[model samples]
Target: MTVRAAQRQVVTERLAGHLLASGLSRTSVRQLAAAAGISDRMLLYYFRDKAEALGEAMGHVAAQLGGRLEAALPAGRRMPPERLLAEAARIATEPEVRPFMALWMEVIAAAARGEAPYAGIASEVTT
Candidate 1:
């Protein structure tokens, strides 16, 4: 990867952790930059806009949750959909996964409000 791409990925990972830990309430540009240990201008330099940055970070968060779920509930089972869902629910409620669930609810709330990026992002992540 290019140096710029590597740096952006690092920032995106940091932003993912920040979003999970802090939720949407503390996600100002300055706050995100602070979490990533960069200037606000540098955050913008790595991403096209706040929406793009947030979308990427949220995608990272989703990937993380997916990894955890996959590890907990491996695929290739022939269980019924209801059973599968029950297992997923049990796994999702674990302490380590709760932050991602909280962030997901926040995103859904934002989407319900017809907020920019979030509506689109939520749809993308759900599917």
Candidate 2:
């Protein structure tokens, strides 16, 4: 990738972390720009709009989490069902997993309500 493209990906990931920390609420463009250390115009330049920016950020967050999960699984070894369950339980109790688990539950609840954005985001992430 070009240097500019790589730089943008890094910037987007930093923005995604901020967005994920806000829970289910939307962050204003000004807030996002400030958090990103850029002007609102620059933020808009990278994204079509706030919703599109949020979608990209959240998608980045999900991809990050999926990478973590993939890293945890062994390459070729077959894990026993009981061992898998035990590892799963351990992960659920981990500090790193707590926020994600909470966020996922919130999304599931929101999806049940048929809410916009999140309902679709949740479905996309899960699938």
Candidate 3:
């Protein structure tokens, strides 16, 4: 990857973890910069805008959650409903899952407010 892409990926991963743990809101540029261990200017250097940065973070979190679900699935057949429910319950109560749940809810709320950036991200990651 290009150095800029690598840096942005690193920041995005860190920022994703932070958002998942803390929940999303009107998280300021300064707050995201703090979570990313960089100045706001540098954060902007990596991301064109707050919405894009937030979208990238959401995508990363979704990828992780999806990876876990995929790993738990059977290779050649659909999972049974009971087993899927059990897995869903198991996942739901995980401490780590709570923040992502909050983040997703925030995204949904944002989309409900008619924010195109969030709606686009909601489609990208939730699908």
List TM-score per model, in order. Answer: 0.94, 0.77, 0.86
User: Which number leads on lDDT?
Assistant: 1
lDDT of 3 at 66: 80
The TM-score obtained by model 3 is 0.86
TM-score order of candidates, best first? Answer: 1, 3, 2
Q: Per-residue alpha-carbon lDDT of model 3 for 1-127, expressed as tens digits?
A: 9999999999999989888877775468899999999999999999998888988988899988788767766457567889889888888778867777778888899888987688898988968
The candidate 2 region of ten consecutive residues with least summed lDDT is: 18-27
RMSD of each: 1.1, 2.4, 1.9
State in Å the error of residue 7, model 2.
4.2
Q: Which stretches of model 2 miss by more than 4 angstroms?
A: 2-4
Model 2: how far is 127 from its true place, Å?
2.8
Candidate 3 C-alpha error for residue 112, in Å: 1.7
What TM-score, to 2 decimals, does candidate 1 have? 0.94
lDDT (tens digit, per residue) of candidate 1 on 1-127: 9999999999999999999999999888899999999999999999988888999999999999999988877877578889989998898898999999999999999999998879988998898
Q: Give lDDT: candidate 3, residue 72.
A: 65
Lowest-sum lDDT 10-residue window in model 3: 69-78
